[model samples]
Target: MHSAIDAATLRAYRDTHYRVRGDTPMTLRIDQPSPALAALHQVHGVDCSAFITAANPHSRRCGDDANARRQLALAQDLERMGLAAMAAAGEHPSNGWPAEPSFLVPGLSLHDARMLGEKYGQNAVVWSGADAVPRLVLLR
Candidate 1:
């Protein structure tokens, strides 16, 4: 259950607001059960989802262009996999970090979510099961 990510960064991930964008935007908090997410899951006919991003790999800040490119690649990869994705952002409540473009991928399994996290060099991903309780899944 351990990862190479540092404690501060791990704490930051837990504190991040994983915002799912739309006309009625929803901010998903770690370890919190979201009614909005439960409704979203009902819409998608899914029992689970994941909040993933392709920015600041391994907790290292990168240029906007690089982050954008990585984000685009992740979108493409998800498209190729035939998965559903909603535009989202990883925003720190205190503005300690820049809001990173992210995705709320409905129906993405926990295993696949972890794989995508590893693929994009993320330290962790926010995942929710049938109960809609998002947990931080750490990756090295």
Candidate 2:
């Protein structure tokens, strides 16, 4: 089962609490879902949807070297779904995001981050929350 959180609430929190700065890539740690891995279900959740719908400009502030990539891969495996499914569920590319989150200050590499999808066909990695529950970030 999946729960929902208001996208507006998340957006306000991001704007007031997680504003990004500079060109250095930033990392947003969104939590994974409960019970078991549920990428699709998680994406459909309110918080995840808010991030997916949020704006992304510049589109080069989010990525992962190898550790972040590997971590996300593990999460993907736990979800048991392909990139396409995740993208469809979240309404974005499954490869990853195209930029760092606008809400957070740049230069923070969160190992807990995950590559949810690629935006506009770019090699970007969307950051996830660190909480145990599922979460998403609105990166730009």
Candidate 3:
């Protein structure tokens, strides 16, 4: 509801790649339609997805230990919610920022996605619908 994130940081979120890794990988770009994501959704029988992380909360850099703990906690939360989450990362193409550990959660509702992002103190999360077009959902 409140937007305090700066323009440059917001731009970076848009430019970043939200990658879901495994045997078959997916690179999701904000505002771009991804066939791989569509296929993943179909496989999961879900029409919605969210790419989220708890690392570097509020965009402030933290130690690996701290980041890892936060990320693990988020994963646990997802597991407790019974949502199927795939290991993923948010990467900046220019290598300006270290890849943040993330998850691609199929069937996550938009409301829940926003809640998680804000709960984790994130500026934004990448989300998609049945159209498979990833969008930058800000939570600041």
Candidate 4:
């Protein structure tokens, strides 16, 4: 089995690079707004206030088709900004733990993320968050 990352190491990296919002940690802030947000707003017509404020926010609550589409749009916008992305997996079939794949940017000092992706059998490192963290896309 692959060695698990130490909590301290993970905590230190997150504390230095991410902001904690409620229970979820926020990473990858958008330096500028993108047109995808506008398109999402027009298409969905739902209150995407949280997304607007957070920019390229990661949502783990995408439990339906519509929510999945919204998450994809947000992830695509982040990719357009030239940020790193990963095709995160959902729960493993054998174990209930998260099997999500992820990768850090070229210089983020988080080698553990890439290693974790490898451990989970997701070897592709791409530039779309949908590939990394969206539940619906992961199922597909």
Mark the regions of model 2 whose C-alpha exceeds 4 Å error after superposition: 1-33, 38-130
lDDT of each: 0.91, 0.30, 0.90, 0.29
Q: What would the per-residue lDDT of candidate 2 be over residues 1-140, giving only the tens digit for each residue?
A: 22143454344333332222333222223343333223322434422221221133123233445324533454444345322212211222233433332222012123322233332222223343333232443332
- Note the residue pairs that clash in candidate 1: none
Cα RMSD to native, each candidate? 1.1, 14.9, 1.3, 16.5
Summarize candidate 3's per-residue lDDT along 15-92 as a digit string, tens digits: 898888986698999999999999988988999999999999999999899999998889888989899788999999
The candidate that wins on lDDT is 1
lDDT of 4 by residue, 1-140 (tens): 22244444233222221121322223432233324433433434422212121111132332355445554554554466554433322222332333232322322112332333333332222221321221111100
- Candidate 1 segments whose C-alpha is farther than 4 A from its true place: none
Q: Tens digit of lDDT per residue, candidate 1, span 21-118? A: 97548999999889999998998899999999999999889989999999999999999999978999999999578899999999999999999999
- Identify the superior model by lDDT, candidate 2 or candidate 4: 2
| Candidate 3 minimal-lDDT segment of 10 residues | 1-10
Q: CA shift at 13, candidate 2, in angstroms?
A: 16
Off by over 4 Å in 4: 1-62, 90-140
